[model samples]
Target chain A: MTHPPLRSEAAELHLSHQPAPEDLERPGRRQLSPADAALMEQKVRKVEVAISLVLRVGVLVSVLVIAVGLGLMFAHHRAYLPLQGDFSYRQLTSGTTPFPHSMASLARALARGDGRGVVVLGVLVLILTPVLRVAVGVVSFLYEHDLPMALVTLYVLAVLVGSFLLAGV
Target chain B: MTPIDFVVSLALVSVAAGVLGSLVGLGGGVVIVPVLTLLYHVDIRLAIGASIVSVIATSSGAAAAYVRERMTNLRAGMFLEVATTTGAVSGAYLTTVLPTQALFVLFGVVLAYSSFATFRRRHTDQPLTVSNDRIANYFDLHGSYYDPAEKREISYKVVGTRPGLALMYVAGLVSALLGIGSGALKVPAMDSAMHLPMKVSSATSNFMIGVTAAASAGVYFIRGQIDPIIAAPVAAGVLLGATFGARILGRVASTTVRLVFVVVLVVISLEMLQKGIFP
Candidate 1:
């Protein structure tokens, strides 16, 4: 029923992947089902390409935002330290933490065009690149009809979101 | 040093680290932490947070090209994520309870072992001589990619699926515990245990690290370790270098890559081992 997963399909699919379903469906289409699977495979390939683009764009966007922030920081203070070092970890036992109270506060600061906020937003985009990739992966697997893989990727995504939300609590 | 001067210097250093790390299939975070904490006198935990973000950046930048070339084993990567994600969550907690120095030494030993595993150089064109692997068969884990340099398609069959998955769990735990070791372990596991081709292993490793690092980066952010000024330029530099590295991965010889990996692994392992022993 599964058609042996591409070993057999490779010969036919690789030969002609351009023909649409309508072109191949002209009555008595012997290879219609395999063609459909091949089409599905091609669609899955698009998802991979999309994932690649998302990662590339996300990183560049983050870099741009961070660069702008650095510029602003230097414009404000061209001295010993352009920005505050409050986020730096002192030690485990020091207990005097300077981390922002929540993600919302960080976002608010970013909206206010604070230099540090812009910088953090860049890092935020960097972190989200992987999360976005995993999200696309779920769609990729489902398109391939590979339910198990979809479930696995979905679970990984869940772990990421859950850990972020529950880390402080 | 002025803060602007410090960030500039750190970003410059990170660019080279990113290039070398990405070229050898180890993301830049491995070296970033050492440079920050030891050379610049940054807090170890703060260096860790910055490096984690850099790992995601490097992985993301490299994965774009690697995955597009069809070298990454998507299904295999997904299957292993189940193990990695679970291991990562547990390892995050382990950080609070365990003696981290001893764990670092242990992971350093593992790195040494991995270096030895990949020390040999083999021709990349040689076909994977595997057969009758039941799990890989059902999952269709085998893949093929066109080698522009070799002027042919390189087909390979993935064996040791279960071992690969189990090793990923260890890699994830070690990564969470150590902050950059996970990405380095992936290629070795794929190359030795799974008998995957070197190029495929590295590319898949690139594809997988972002997800693994993301699992922990979140915790680092919430804990107040990810400093924007520190993390930003470092991430940008690493991402830039990794993007360049990914484009050339298809052209570079596997033998050369393996030899370079062995050298980097030995140096990093010795450094980590030394730190653990002295600290």
Candidate 2:
């Protein structure tokens, strides 16, 4: 689109008197140049917001579940008796140590409303936070039509998810 | 002590660790691991399992602020994460094969480096001569963010893409093996080699550590290392503390945070070294 010469010249004059780079309070104002770059910036901003929300929610839910479990576990002397000798954390560090069998079993207990199950659910969610973050990244990059970056993030998500498969989960 | 009492004490300690870690920019793992292994007498694997969980918790909890600020470079973080996640998986497996003593020694060495770097800190790195690289271009691993401190937008291009990728692999390996956030190494790699500004490198490093720790966490989880009874309170405490720490960071003087870090890291580093040497 062609602008009138006088209007174009006025726009240039407006730009020339603009604030110095250091005086620009908003970082995006300087960098959000050209039409295409601005669009990319907006998309990336959305992705960041989405990622932050996912993480915050994941942490909040996990903390709540764990708090409930702690209240229950210590409400009486149930979990108190054996905790001394348990200080070495012997029971806490073995493979397939018979906590709730598997994630499915944990879910079942959660349905049953057991304290242990609630705690397990919290842990599971916390662990899955990064997986979810990467999943969002894949979608974010794909939305931007940046295949290399999308694939890059996809590879990371694959490794994270693949470990579960390798672990026989 | 009663289990409740023990758990309470552990949580209190973890809260302190989380505060100091976040304040010192080491995250919580570096502080918690030593406290757990040396003071609590928890097995390294068990302690590591909990530390890794706390790391994820803390990282995720802190993500929202950095992301919204746009200090974190999404494309750069994603590209580097490919290398980090793979390295982390490999390192996690190595933990099963390697002895605990070896981990202690490695942890001590890493802590020493972390301490030295913290003491002689450079919040903004000196720019590298080379300003661009092919892989960086391919992945679009460059970014610009508004720096409120400078009152301007800071734009930078990444360089030494291949070297940065390799260093990231090492960072991932260290993170998995030590159950650390690995920002200590990742920041340097990006700041020095990749030519990212200090803000972007550290912010981006923070993002990658979460994903990398998650990759190793799965293996730890399946192995029954993540005991909810122990992990739940510890993670909760760290998250609470980290959140609080971030809020107060700007008010606290940088010199003070650095002084605290120097003292903490020096003590932790020596303890880990002794444990490794004696064991």
Candidate of highest DockQ: 1
Task: Supply DockQ values for each candidate.
Answer: 0.25, 0.23
**Candidate of highest TM-score:** 1
Candidate 1 CAPRI category: acceptable
Error of 2 at B93 (Å): 3.3
Q: Write the per-residue lDDT of candidate 1 for residues B1-279, one digit (tens) a residue.
A: 557667778889878877776777777887888888878777777888888877777788888778888878877887778788787888898888877788778777777767875774354335454434456655567778876567677887666666667778878887888776576778877777667778788778877777888888878887778876678678878888887887777887778777877888898889879879997
lDDT of 1 by residue, A1-169 (tens): 1122112223322322222233322234244388886886687688788888888788789889889877776666545354455333232212343434258878787777777777777778888889888998898888777777788889999998877776852
Candidate 2 per-residue C-alpha lDDT over B1-279 given as tens digits, one digit per residue, 9 for 90 to 100: 555665778788778766665544456787777777777666677778888887776677666666777877878888988888888878867877777677677667766765665455445344332333556655656678776555667677666666667767877876776565666567656654566765566557667777888887767776667777678778888888777655444344434545675676677668768878996
lDDT of 2 by residue, A47-152 (tens): 8888888888888888898899767655633545564654434454444345653767777877877776777778878888889999988998888887888888
State the lDDT at B2 in candidate 1: 53
| RMSD over all Cα atoms, model 2 | 10.5
Segments of candidate 1 deviating more than 4 angstroms: A1-41, A80-101, B121-125
Error of 1 at B115 (Å): 0.9
Q: What fraction of correct interface contacts does each candidate retain?
A: 0.49, 0.49
Q: What TM-score would candidate 2 get against the native? A: 0.80
